[model samples]
Target: MFVRTVYATGDPAELGTAIRALNSEGRDLLEERPGYRGAGVFVDRNLGKLLTVSWWESEQARHNSDEVMRERRTALLAPFAGTLAVENYEVAVFHVLPRPTAHGGLHLIRLEFEPADADQLADAFHATVVPRLEALPGLARAALFLDRERGHGLAGTLFTDHHSLAASRAAQAAARQAGAAKVQMAVVGLEEFEVVHADAHAG
Candidate 1:
């Protein structure tokens, strides 16, 4: 699977309005596109940042939506956005813990690491990271996406709520470090986000 993410920063109030507009205008349109799978919006009200991600079956499908997405973004977010960035990645692993109970309000973590030794990284994720994540308190789901040839990786993790996420910070930090080292990779970026709008079909 392939993924595209739009990162934006703006006023909380304007962001709320912009997001609603996106839902009605562009979000729904994605589902009608070829190879569309799912999408989700992640925001941080206090930080005034939002990250929207959409899933596609292939790079071509993702690229096909670029023009329309660009137009929509320019029309809707131009006034509200302070900064904007877009990125694409290949999904290496997508795992949802069975029977997740805790619900409502999600604490999301996005970690990017170097992708050296792709095979080793993938192996370590399944053997080490997966189990640790599944055992984490209040974890809902986690996915690791990588560009094997480019030496880039994106790890997205969702927690049940703020407290649950904060409580696991220590352990998560340790695991992140160990995992990166195991694959001879360096941590490039790590950020926290709030899941603002999620739907049944969202990835």
Candidate 2:
């Protein structure tokens, strides 16, 4: 599967209203598009940053839906406008345990690395990172998205609640450090978010 990410920073005061619009009107519009798989909406309220990820069955499907997506994006973000950026990625790994729930916590990490090391990175992720995360309490899902040509990647781990997320922080950091060193990937960005909405389907 492929995914398109829309990210922006907006007015913190309008965060709730923006999320509501995304969960309702935005989602409805996306569902009408062909090849729509699923989507996740995340927000860092304090920073007024929001990220929306929508999955598609193929790159073509994602491309075809771009215009409409931009239209939706404009309308939804108008109230809380800030800098906007978009990226496309291929889903490299997706692991789910008990499934995700609304208001769950998300640990998000962004990385930069050598494009040529993609295979080695994937191997290390599966052989090391996945196992370590699986052992964490309250963990629900883990996903990795890659833009091989740009040497960019994003990883996310979902926790069932705030307590679980707080409890696993130290362990998560250690695991992330070890996994990144194993593949020589530089950790560029790391942040926490609340899962505003999540709806996924099994293949």
Candidate 3:
């Protein structure tokens, strides 16, 4: 699968309204596009930031839906009246205990890293990171999106609630350090997000 994520930093006052608009209007529009598989959003009310990620079956499907997505973005973000940035990535590893829902107490960590051996890195993720996360408290899902050749990647992890998220931090950090060694990556950016909406298929 391929994923496209749009990120925005808006006024906190208007950000909530915009995010709710996405859960309704924006989500419906995304569902209509070709190859649309799953859609999610992260709202950081305190910081006034929102990130929306939509999944597609292929890179071509992702590209084809740009026009409609652009229109939807303009209308939904109009109230906030600011610019947003979009990024595309290829899904490498997607592991979950169960499907996720809109109410998921999502805490996401987006890590930007330099790439090395793509295959070896993928193996390291499954062998190391996946197992560790699978055993974490209240974790719902974990996914990785990458442009291996370009040496950039993003990872998202959803936890059940604040306590689960907080308790797992130290373990996640340690695991990340170990995984980083095997993945041969240079960390660039790492940020936390609150999941405002998440819809995952269970079949």
Candidate 4:
């Protein structure tokens, strides 16, 4: 599987409007394309940041939609977005305890390292990090996305609610450090968001 992620900065108050646009118009646009699986939108009100992720069955399908996405993004997201960055990744690991829901808490850990270390990082994520995360309360899903060429990756965990998300922070921090050391990757950043919407049509 493959994924495209969009990171944007905008007014916190306008996030709701953006989410609606994404879930309706954006979703409809992507669904019309071949190999489209599903997508979600998350927001960090404190930072006025939003992350949108869409899944595809193959890299070719993902690349094919880039031009259309640029146009749709201009219409749906440009007004609110002060800054926007788009990235593509290979899905290294994906495990769902349950389907995600609105108001779910999302935590993302970003990593950076040499492209040569990509496989090692993926292995460590699957063998070590995922198990620890699965044991946490209210874990709805976890996924790791890696861009080998860019030597960038991010792991995201969605919890059922705020309390469960908060409760797992300490454990997640420890796991993050340990996993990074095991894979010799740098833990570049960590961020949190509220899942405004989520859906998965393909496993």
Candidate 5:
């Protein structure tokens, strides 16, 4: 799998308008493109930063869709260019492990963190969280990303249903209780979204 993540920083006062435009463009791309999968958008609590993450079946699909996406983004930001700063990245590490059957609707979890602890937080999720979640029923896939140079991060997990999501949450809570690592973790933010549609490019 290939993942593309975009990080943008803007005036806190304009975040709402920026997010709406971004999400609208996201929905349009996912609906109109053949190789598009799903995506998640997260806003830092500080309200000054936003991260948008999307998955593609392969690098080629991502490259193929870039022109359309570029146009959409340009149109969306025309009015707010000076107030917002945007950066895009082609992810180097993308891993998704299978999970068992789940019950309920599909759920996506979008997580964000502060700069200092991003790596350690990511490690804990990879070493502890991913393994535990993969064992639960209804968990479908999990992906992790880090913008090392940008000092930002994003992680997502897809559940077969709500039940699996609940179960996975419980497991995460338990892991936290065990006092794993003190990576200065903070829920810098979160966003909940549905998989409106998806298309995987053939390898």
Candidate 6:
């Protein structure tokens, strides 16, 4: 699957209403697009920024729907422009596995790393971490991306809940013990966020 995430910083006063409108627009578009899978909107407690993420069956599908998405997003945020700072991202990797929970919700985790460690981290994640986590229960997906223009390397995972996140971490630790640590290095000076939200596209 392909993942696209957009981050918007909104005035505290207008945040709630803005997020609702944006989420509604996204939901409507996703519902009409065949390749649309799922999505969620998360508000950061500390920064008060909102992150909107969606999954698509392919990059083309996402691109094909861009015009409509742009129009909807513009209309949704017209009233909140002065209160919001918007940015969109094209996800480079999206790996989908299975969620352990039968309840069908999604837990999302995003990590942003320094540019210097991008290559090594990406390699380590794909070669070691990804394979191990992919085997764990509730690990619905994993994706890695390099945003050189923005000096960021992004990695994300989708799970059913805290248990799945814990399991995935444990699996990664085990992989490190098994000699995957050489290529991997702890990511410092990074920003991370964890969010739990309902699957807006759930059938």
Candidate that scores best on lDDT: 4
Predicted structure 4: lDDT: 0.87
lDDT score for residue 164 of model 5: 59
Write the residue-wise lDDT of candidate 4 on 95-184 in tens digits. Answer: 888645679899998989899989999999888898888999899988889999999998999998888999999999888877877888
After superposition, candidate 2 runs with Cα above 4 Å error: none
Superposed Cα deviation of residue 35, candidate 6 (Å): 1.7
Give the clash count for model 1: 0
* C-alpha RMSD of candidate 4: 1.3
lDDT of each: 0.73, 0.86, 0.77, 0.87, 0.55, 0.57
**Candidate 3 structure lDDT:** 0.77
Q: TM-score of predicted model 3?
A: 0.91
TM-score per candidate, in order?
0.86, 0.96, 0.91, 0.95, 0.52, 0.59
lDDT tens digits, residues 1-203, model 6?
55566666656566667667765765776779778877766555456566667766776877776667766775675554454333344455556654433333333434455567666666677776677767777776666655545645445666666566665665645754442354434333323344535352322
Off by over 4 Å in 4: none
Comparing 1 with 4 on lDDT, the higher-scoring candidate is 4
Show model 5 residue runs off by greater than 4 Å: 5-68, 73-122, 175-182, 198-203
Model 3: per-residue Cα lDDT over 1-203, one tens digit each: 88888888878889868877887888888888888988888877788888888889889999999877886786787676366888888888888776444555555555555565766766777788888888888888888788876767776778867677778889888778888877676556667667776765422
Off by over 4 Å in 6: 78-123, 130-142, 146-152, 157-189, 194-203
Candidate 2, run of 10 with poorest lDDT: 194-203
Residue-level lDDT of model 2, residues 1-203, one tens digit each, is: 89999998989998888888888888888899998999999899998999989999999999989878886787887787578899999888888897556898899999888999877877788788999998888899888888999999998899888788889899989889879778899999998988887766536
Greater TM-score among 5 and 6 belongs to 6
What is the Cα-based TM-score of model 1?
0.86
Worst 10 residues of 5 by lDDT: 194-203
- The local distance difference test score of model 6 is 0.57
Which residue pairs collide in model 2, if any?
Answer: none
In model 3, the runs with Cα more than 4 Å from the true position are: 99-101, 113-116
